[model samples]
Target: MPNFKLTISDIKGKSVSKELKDSDANPLLGLQLGNETDASIVGLSGKLKLTGGSDKSGVPMRNDVHGSARKKILLSKGVGLQDAETGQRKRKLMRGNTVSEEIYQVNCKFNGELPVEAPAEETTEEKAEEKKE
Candidate 1:
């Protein structure tokens, strides 16, 4: 029973965030990075590829890792390591590619057109009030 924050991105570089409760998130469990799933589970009509995610402790997932557990690996340049100098390597903590209950945020890439949500229309009364000002 894990709640997850889904960050869905499109080809245009735009992203949308959606929330998934325990029930809705069940289908996403055990999924690893680079795996594709049906977006219909999230109320979308395209396929979504698992890019990456972070655990509750803010540990980022790395594709090279095999399981859902967290590990401290020697990373020179990758998902969990940042600002590495030339030929620099350090032991950093990172989560595995698999999605687990401890994962808080899930990153996904959409494969098709992302529907744009229209903004709410202003009521006649509200428009009249705005014109009066």
Candidate 2:
């Protein structure tokens, strides 16, 4: 089975991840952007929602999330994440000493893997040997 990894990040620097096979994720992800060279094979279905955190009552907060028909998600690239905008205005309410907090605004992206690195030099080892009593 082909495995695809997805990384989700918020503006506040919080992140969540999910692993799904091509068959499972393909359905949730759209493919309208397949024709574009800049875009990847998977497109945002526009149904993805980010969580804003929760209230004192443990209720999940809600806010306005931005989306477009043209945005695409590159699963195995640099940032892996794409365009994401949190609502300018959060759902604010004030009453009974309960202070409303801003919800978490997040964007989803994907990760490829660690970049290849060259072998380390041994200059440090030589210097340490010279310094030994």
Candidate 3:
């Protein structure tokens, strides 16, 4: 019953957002950072690697942290800490690497091309009806 908002990034630096709910998001449960999963569940043609994610409260997940709980760790330069001065460190609350129900946004890297859906062709009946008008 986990709901996840996925941020999928490709090699070209373009990013796409997708939302998965209930059973569609179950496959991502318990996955950790850097772990790869099949992207077909999300309609992508390649592999999708877990990069990072944030909980419902906006706390980020750090790769070095294990388990699925949140912790206050001393971070100088990493996923949670940004724009720090030289030799500066701070204890920031960040989530663990594992994906859990609390996680709201999941960041992923896609290894293949996105599928392009073809347009539906009009049937002869529809074409004939249009011609009559």
Candidate 4:
């Protein structure tokens, strides 16, 4: 059950989209191909810009959120399936769904966050030069 087309871009770009189908085995939907995630526009608040889906051996689990600003996410269905006619392929029961469950289509976006760097404060002349060594 893979048919997701979720897009949410906020940071001034203002964007919103949603479509989902679940089978419940969530491996981040095998996130692949030009992947980027930090989704959370379902109700709007913070976090938008992401991607991930297609891992029934259909390949495309290219995870690359090299930058994280995840504002909470949780989806399921993508660990194993494909053998409706001896197509052979199984091994995904971390929770359930698999007797014939192969439907994936995820398109995502929720642009924002992941660029944090603020932790450098030592100005007492370097703390008295480390207490004069």
Q: Pick the candidate with the highest TM-score.
A: 1
What's the CA RMSD of model 1 in angstroms?
A: 1.8
| Model 2, CA-based lDDT | 0.32
lDDT of 1 by residue, 14-67 (tens): 899999997999999999999999999889998999999999889999999999
Report the number of backbone clashes for model 1: 0
* TM value for model 1: 0.91
Q: Give the Cα lDDT of each candidate.
A: 0.93, 0.32, 0.92, 0.40
Supply the TM-score for candidate 4.
Answer: 0.23
Provide TM-scores for the models: 0.91, 0.24, 0.84, 0.23
Q: What lDDT does candidate 2 reach at residue 61? A: 23
Global fold similarity of model 3 (TM-score): 0.84
Residue 111's C-alpha lDDT in candidate 1?
90
lDDT of 4 by residue, 28-123 (tens): 454343544444324444544334443244433323322222211222333233333334444332221111234243435555532334889889
Model 3 segments more than 4 A misplaced: 115-133
User: How high is the lDDT of residue 20 in model 2?
Assistant: 48
Candidate number achieving the greatest lDDT relative to the actual structure: 1
Query: Which segments of model 2 are wrong by more than 4 Å?
Result: 28-133
Q: All predictions: root-mean-square deviation over Cα?
A: 1.8, 17.4, 4.5, 14.5
- Model 3: colliding residue pairs: none
